[model samples]
Target: MSKPTPLSGFPEWLPAQRMIEQNVVERIRATFELYGYAPLETRAVEPLDQLLRKGETSKEVYVLRRLQEDPGARTDDSLGLHFDLTVPFARFVLENSGKLQFPFRRYQIQKVWRGERPQEGRYREFLQADIDVVDRDNLPFHYDTEMPLVIGDAFASLPIPKATILVNNRKVCEGFYRGLGLEDPDQVLRTVDKLDKIGPEKVAALLVETAGATDAQAAACLKLAAISTGDASFVDQVRALGVTNDLLDEGLEELVRVVDAGTEYAPGLIRAELKIARGLDYYTGTVYETQLQGYERFGSICSGGRYENLATSGNERFPGVGISIGVSRMLGLLFGHNALTISRSVPTGVVVALPAEELRPACDRIAQALRRRGISTEVAPAAAKFGKQIRFAERRGIPFVWFPGADGEPDTIKDIRSGDQVEADAATWAPPAEDLIPVVSKA
Candidate 1:
């Protein structure tokens, strides 16, 4: 048989790395829960038409079908893998609106499939952690402001260095574009989205050549894209653009609101940027992208925006604004480099060694008691040499090695990191509180 092919964009980690992934996800879930956001999980597959209801998103979606059957086989029909949590959540809310409470706060953790060309930091299959609030008619503007800070806190709490989240509003970009005479504002947004990839000079050339923008218009667009500042001066700069369009002014106001709210809570957390052009067509209000401080060239590790009327299940609406954390891309930076980390996987609090064949039950009992006391314990698989067993425990990063001393000491625990071994009883034995819980990287 030939060797298996390496699938692009779908990253798989070793056991240790998976433990780190688990920690990252659990932290996000915990943060969401702490804020009184209820958890909801939707089915993995939806009707193809429902999944691809949005014409633009349909292009990137991957349709799922089994290949074992004949080509002419009577269909189980076209069912596609859910692309993102937001779309499926919309359909779920619409299908079950009666069951949901208004201003429904929810967090969804699931895998979404996108059939785009897989490249570095981009994936065909990945886990997305999303939290959004879907209101009865209009999603609260405060929810729009609060979502980013909550997400930023999750990143800040992680082992990664300080992260900066750049936020912009789609309405603002659209208003500015329409005021500047681009009837096809969507096309202009698409061109601007590539500003980081192709550089401003090239993007300006493309705008004039393809988007029907005059040199002056292109120059103005380039100038607007280049503006990013910590202070409110950006508000003045856009005002100075002197293109008096009511809609443009409205967009600018929306930006001010989002930036001000973000700043009030975290004080210099959100950066107001004019050039951020999020690629998704559905975002009608706010758009966001996150980059690590020294890892900007690695591109946006997380991004999302607001959508006006996203939910339509042949029923009422489920309008929402939320963000997604690219678990894989973030980990790509997190696992290997100095950016982020967690105490090793196999975060075993205690490891019980087996002295002989008959001593195994005691080891099991010891492990069970430790686990009952909220300690993660692992018992040696076999009666092996003490050196070998100690290595096993050490390899797993198990801090405490409990060796059964039947005669004098019933339980003896060892601190692998410090080589401190002590005698104690299993029922009352306790490790350091920090060791009981694994150490994770932080700011």
Candidate 2:
């Protein structure tokens, strides 16, 4: 048989890299919990109809089927792996509405799949860290501004470079489109969403040919998309556009509130970029797109928005605002570029070396004693020369090597890097606090 080959989009990281990934996840989880958000998880598969509710993402949905099926089995209702966490969360809220509390806040970090072709930062299977606030009815508008702040906290705790969150509201886009005398505002929003992929020239042409916008209207849309400010100054810029509509007025006010809060709380981190039309159909309010500093070409590493009517059941509407960090994608890009690092490969802090195979029991006892003291300890695989034992610890990035006491002598531990040998009792010995756990940092 031929040697096995690795898949392109399915990422597998080395031991040190996985350590960095775990640290990132823990930091994000801790931040989410600090804000009073509970943890949640949803199954991987959902009915095909539910997955296809958003028409644009249908092409990326991956369906699952058994290799062998009964000849007469019915296949009317099919299943597909969920392309995103938001869809599954919406279903969970509707299914468990009665059991959950009002204004439910949840943080979910899980793997999601998409069948789209992967390139650069995009992946077919990836991990996402998502936090959302859902309400039974009449969701508070203040939650819209709070979404980015939560994301800001999570990202700030990680070792990666800073991220700038670009904010936009669907009401802003729709109102401006209607004010321009455009009949289909949704189509215009979708077209404008492609501004990053295709240049503004192509977007403007498509707006005219597909969305039925006049040259002046398309220009106006382009101009609106170009308005981005670090604070509430964007409101004055939009007002300067000379557009007047009730929805536009309302959207402007809401955008101002969100921008002002972000400025006051997470100053210089949030920006009001009017052209950020989130492509998702369900997003009826504020939308977000995040760009990592010095990595803008890879596109948004995190994004989400407010959905006013995403989850509904028999007259009860659940509206929510959320943000999702594309964890796998971010890590993959950083790892590929050698931007992340971990000081150690394995969790073991010290390796106990046996002078002879007969001292296996003693080595085991020493390891156990250290472990009870909250220290990570491992025993050398076999009895070998002192130099060989030291090499074993060095190869795995284990900082220290412990020699088992012979003939009733006290235990001695050697700091492998410095070759400093010190006598100590197994019960009271401890590694430095910084060396207890692997250190992850930005390279």
Candidate 3:
């Protein structure tokens, strides 16, 4: 037999670490449900064509096939593990459009696979917590504003560091580039999106070589990307840039609406960051990227955008706005830094001590009573000396140990950590609220 080695990009957490992850997920799920979003789950694989229809994600799709299938079978309709929830959701909406109502809102928490090089906060397989609102035909612009507020509330409920959501509208970038007389706005956006990675000098060169932009036009594009504001004042800043176009004006108005809404509701949570050109071709309106306050270099721990035409049924269009929390990425960074604490490694609150194998039935009854009252309890694995039994509870961090009464005496319990043993009844005894379950908190 060989020792097991870890796969590079797949993350596996210890029990204490997993408790923190579960706590974070529950908080996010509760926040999503509080905002009227219903839960949803989609199949893990989608047709490769549908997964590749939206962006430059073709390289990231993990294609699937049956090992015993014919080798010469047609591969055009091959299936691949979904890289993100949005694409499968779009396909789901289109497939079930007739049964679904208008303005469908859903929150999905599932593992998505991507074939990419692993890093500190990036993984080949990861969990994504996503929320999206899709409407028939014309989707309201206000949904764009609503997306970040929900995300803000979710992050607020977590134990992680504060998350700042950086927002921008595609129309703003495309219109600004067109206003500067650049013919290939999309190419320019794709180039500028790498500004953080390649820097301004390299991005400027790529703009000229790839997007066919003149030096002055590339400078204007860079200038637009540099505009970031905490409020609607960004509207005036863009105006000051001296570029004029109707689409740019429309985008500015939409972005200001989002920023203003964020200000009134979740102040200091959202910002108009012009450089957040999401590297997806499907995004037609506002885009978002979230940065954990001190872990900015790890890149966006949450991201998504508004796509007006990702799902279509002939003349009908299902436009939507969404955001996804990179659950694995955030946990990876936090766990790597030892930023979370768990009160206990296991959820057990009380361990019914076994005095003898003959009294196992009595101990089982005591365990059932504690569980009936909502206290997580387990019976001792073996009948051992009282001292050995207490050591067993302490080893697993179980707070209380119960001893069954013998010879008509009342049963008793012990708080092993404090050595506080007292006569008690299994039917009436209960631990304090905090000790009933494992508590997860910031270290």
Best prediction by TM-score: 2
| Ranking of predictions according to lDDT | 3, 2, 1
TM-score of each: 0.93, 0.98, 0.97
Per-candidate Cα lDDT values, in order, are 0.80, 0.90, 0.92
What is candidate 1's TM-score against the reference? Answer: 0.93
Q: Which residue segments of model 3 deviate by more than 4 Å? A: none
Between prediction 1 and prediction 3, the one with superior lDDT is 3
| Candidate 1 local lDDT, 1-443, one digit each (tens) | 99999888778987777777888889889888887789889888887877766636777778778878678975556888898888888888887889988888898888888887776667788888888888776777777888888887888667776677898877777777888887777888889999989998899899987889988888888778877976556878887786667777777777788788778778767888888988767788888888888778888887888787887545466678888888887886665464555565677878888999888887898889889898888888889998898888777777778888877655677887898888877788888888886676642
Q: Write the per-residue lDDT of candidate 3 for residues 7-46, one digit (tens) a residue.
A: 9999988888888888899999999999999999999999
Cα lDDT tens digits, model 2, 134-168, are 99887899998898898899899988899999998
Pairs clashing within candidate 1: 159-441
lDDT, model 2, position 321:
92
